[model samples]
Target: MSAINKVLFIAPRFHTNQIGIVKALLNEGVEVEFHVLIKGPTEDYAVLTPIKIEEGKFSRFLSKFLKTQKVNKYYAFPSFFEYFNTIKNFNADLIIIRDPGRFFSIVSTIIAKLLGIKICFYTQETLEIEAKNTFRYFFQKFYKTIFHAEWITPIGGTDTRIKKFLPFVVESRFDYLNETSAIEGYSSEKAVAVIGKFTARKRLIWALKLAQEFDCKIKIIGENTTKEHATVYQELLEYVEEHNLGDNVEFMCNLSHSRTLKELSCSNFFLLTARNEPASISVLESLSVGIPVICPLECGTSSYLTPEKTGYTYRQDDYDDLKNKFRRLLVHVSEDKKIRVECLNSSAENFSEQAYINKFNYIFKRE
Candidate 1:
């Protein structure tokens, strides 16, 4: 079990980022299995989702009974026996438990511990973002203290609450593009691109407002997967009609990962208005394609942002600040031709497949 040859990831929903992770592991000759309980139709999927797992009636009922709406979309967990058997049969050298705050991760933690398996807690959460989730944040605290993993690896969280951190690595499909194509894809146009889940937290409405005010073309892409999010999506559509923004703004949904990036690649820049976004894979995806990003402060992926070089960061939830920074970024991009090169360099040094494999080695070395 001390070896790092095999790995298991148990996540609530399947994200395109996981495909990158799985491929990176496989390239290193590590056997991997991703047990997905939910296939989020709106997760900006690149390809078809994998692993069509079978869930019995009782397990599905219990999972739904304990579901929390705040996690976004519905998800289920396999029965204890199935989860236990999967871990036992895989007998992986390393178990990367993501969303340590979720019920599925909690159950997996206890089972992994009972079987004496080694685990490395992988999270995109900073404590500040966790606190936003309230009760689940508390559950994360309890889980950390009680269930004890050998290591805690986070994706670009600088929160001091965690004593030590081995950075979690991630990349996008765009990373494979040649430098010429990557640079060529960034258009001279003024259109701003926004992509992610169509939730209030993602601030699609705010992105629309900015687009309308600037009188710029906007490509808004994401899925409205839940009833709660659907309301927000409707509001976006209504705003487009009411403000006569139909000509300026375009709405898209259920786009494959490549298609999303392709759409974004042609934009002047990428805009993310979310607050407390814990290490946005979306941000890195934009950077990978040589598109500069405009995100809020505390966006974990902003670690790659170098003031006026790659992109810029605004104060979270501050629309005024966002407007001000957006103006500054546009002005700077017009003057700075080096943004594209800088963006690609940042993506390669931070979230490339090489980076993922390098950070992965640290989990085994953790004391």
Candidate 2:
């Protein structure tokens, strides 16, 4: 329904997630082009970085003032003209910008406004009602007014109260999982799966506690925490030894994507132990495989979870609450056979590649 013909997306970095959107646009007869400002770990994808800013003390200082983690990112004033020309030559009907509050975003907004091009911003920032009276609030209002740019978020900024602060809202998520075969072989003997590195921030030890208290099996799948690895890895091993959870817990490392899905196929249920995860893709991957997810309330994708249907959510700060929710999910995993199908339906409905494409088109349609 969106009158999309030709569009340009500007971002600081591009990842695999953008592939679905591009393919969808192409399929819809909408010409699409992307321009990024940073390089990923590899050169496997086709991307154009019009400007490169050298990382230095000055860049880091500006990033601190902006409260941004991208310390290496800055405005390459010298390349402004060249970047402007590239964007102008694209001749896009609408421009989409991600990574708001960065120098690159501001510069692109200014250029797009000058060229009289319609603009949209994509963000992951959560809506905070308490900050309404702050200077940041007024600054945001000014920015939105001056640039005439509407904000779109894949996570957060969806609450009706916050819509008054933001010009408009799209209460949806854009998470896309690759084609998945739902795991129909969930077994009683299978362990509850937790996926992530053995990092302290991930709070994987909680999964261990579930195994210890409930006499259940646990599968910890991710990179790191092998026999001889970092301290956190050793710490996990030490806990396994001290609690005699060696048999109760299993560790897998450096698995291929297909292999990981295969492991998930047999899991009793999936548990996301990380706190304040903006939006963990593991939850989507788990849902895709037809396993219920137990994730923290602070996770952005927690919005997708419908209790007793998809999965249950608990507060990240409350350890007891997680145990309670997992305990409840554990019961359903054994007593209910229909949850797998429901989880699969939820994945296809919300997080599949097609679903993401539809959401993108809807955002434009609603425009």
Residue 61 of model 1 has an lDDT of 75
Give one digit per residue, the lDDT tens place, for model 2 in 115-226.
8888887665555522455676676667667788765655552433222211121111212222332333446578888887667778888888889999999999866734
**Highest lDDT, which number?**
1
The 10 consecutive residues of candidate 1 with the worst lDDT sum are 155-164
Using all chains and alpha carbons, the TM-scores for the candidates as numbered come to 0.83, 0.77
User: What lDDT score is found at residue 291 in candidate 2?
Assistant: 76
Best-matching candidate per TM-score: 1
Alpha-carbon shift of residue 70 in model 2 (angstroms): 5.5
Model 2 per-residue lDDT at 14: 61
> Considering summed lDDT, which 10 consecutive residues are worst modelled in model 2?
165-174
Clashes of each: 2, 0
lDDT of 1 by residue, 34-146 (tens): 76666665454332245544554676677657657566323445577876887799897777777665666767778889898776676765545555677765665665666
Where in model 2 is the C-alpha error above 4 Å? 1-3, 15-23, 37-78, 128-137, 156-185, 223-231, 256-258, 352-359
Global lDDT of each candidate: 0.70, 0.67
Could you list the CA RMSD of all candidates, in the order they appear?
3.9, 5.5
